[model samples]
Target: MPLITIIGAGPGLGLEIARAFGQKGFDVALVARDQSKLDALAQTLAGEGIHAQGFTADVSVPATITNALQSIRETLGPIDVLEFSPADRTLESVDALKVTMENLQPQIDFYLGGAVTAVGAVLPDMIESNTGTILVTTGGGSLAPTPARGNINIAAAGLRNWTLNLNSALADTGVYVALVAITALIGGGRPDAEPAVIAKEYVKLHAERRDAELHYVAYDR
Candidate 1:
């Protein structure tokens, strides 16, 4: 079975992507900060007859990420598809930001940094093995000028460009690096945003090609 590692796993898109791929018979690794939440997701997946494993991981914390990945690798074997779908901070304007852990740039970096670092570690194995897919979920870099969601924009842009650079370098070697850029609001449809259709489009991009680097919306894909 194809083993898929989902980083930044949260409630909405994260779980939806998980279930979507899980239906395709992939062994899904659910990574999150809350063990109980991951456990619950894993249990729920079990009912679908899909092999799922939960790992307690904090995206900003390097040690926790390494430990969690190691644990998941031990439990479910090597990962074939890597999806980074972490839900950190909202892409709110600076003026709209209030005081909270989720209101800061460091909070964004915590998950972003962890995801990249973990991917760095895992890439060597995938490269040596000459296979695997790396899918990074875009936060708010889809806008032309980009969203002013504090540091999340920075981290998300980093992920987006990093995937491009990495994909360019690894294309000949068979390591597929791609992006799932969702420009719509988190609520599926806000005043004027459609996240679901954008998400499904992302899935299609990956499913159609082995080597594809795509952007979600309002930008060159």
Candidate 2:
């Protein structure tokens, strides 16, 4: 079975995504900061007859992420699909005038730096094998930035552009890269943002090898 490594795996959307691919017979490598949470998630998947293992790592730390990927490769074989989700999602409105480097740096490191580390680790193998898929979960703020959340928007935008550029560089190499731009409040108890519903879109993205982007809205326009 193919392995799917989900970085920043946690509750809600992450778990749902795990279940979605796991049910499809994909061995899952769940990476998160909390060992207990990862173990619990793995046990739950095991109960459902889905193969899953947990690896603890801090996404912002490149060495930690690299180590986790190495351990995962030794345990679960090479990863076929990589799903990256930023662990820090706290949104604080910052004044455009007051936005200092200190305020913006955290988000940049968490989103952009973390993505570079995670993707770089597995990309070599994918390139050598000539097959792989990278799916990043980004917020709509990245596509349509607002001054109200300038820090997050700026960082997210950088990550989105990075993914697009990576995809361009890897074009025609049998590796597919895509983004799921979520415009809705995920796991906010709304129908459209439902974890299971949103997860299906991810599965579809992987199976169909669709375009480079998907805008997932939480409510009807």
Candidate 3:
């Protein structure tokens, strides 16, 4: 059976992806900071008699992620799909943006450390197994450079490009690196943007798993 690990299990995207895979008979492992949330989700899936397990971890911490993935492998076998759902803010809005060199540095550091560490911990396993997927949820932060929000953008773009480069280098090795980015409000398209419709599109992007460095899932206006 194929095993999948979702690192950032949001109620919508995270849960939806898990549900999709579960429906397809994949042994899904839900990973997040909140054990209760994963528990509730696992319970719901169990009601459907889906084989699911909830694992908790702070993906930002390499050790936590390393141990967590090891446990999942032990229980469900090697991970076939590694999904990074960002327990922290994948999207940083302008309203909450505080432009400070000191404050922003930490955020940048976190993103870089988080991405590299998470990928590092799992890449080896994927290579050894000879076939696996690492899916990172990139957000609008990767679109462009920002004055206040540039830090996250910088980090995401760095991860995306670095990942693509790695993928190119490893093409003969049989491992794939991909990014799923949410460009607009995931729910709806303005007053006209229906949340359900937008979500479907977002889901499609992940399902497609395009080789593009970053896939911007946006609603048509």
Best by lDDT: 2
* Candidate 2 residue spans exceeding 4 A from truth: 89-95
lDDT of 3 at 76: 86
Per-residue C-alpha lDDT of model 1 across residues 100-175, encoded as one tens digit per residue: 4555467456646766787886898889999878887775563334534544565566667777788788887767
Candidate 2 lDDT by residue in tens digits, 1-221: 99999998988888899999998989999999999999999999999999999999998788999999999999989999999985675635475666778888988888889999999999999999999999998888889756777777788899989888888888889899998889887778788888889999999999998678887878853
> Relative to the unseen true structure, what is the C-alpha lDDT of residue 206 in candidate 1, on a scale of 0 to 100?
57
Ranked candidates (lDDT, high to low)? 2, 1, 3
Tell me the tens digit of each residue's lDDT in model 3 across 1-221. 88778887767667777777776677889888888988998887788877788888886567887888888988888898887757366545332255456555555556657777777888898898787777777766665554555656666677677767776877777777766665666655453233344334434544665564555556565
Computed on alpha carbons, the lDDT of every model, listed in order, comes to 0.70, 0.89, 0.70
Clash pairs, model 3 backbone: 187-195, 189-193
Candidate 2 global CA lDDT score? 0.89
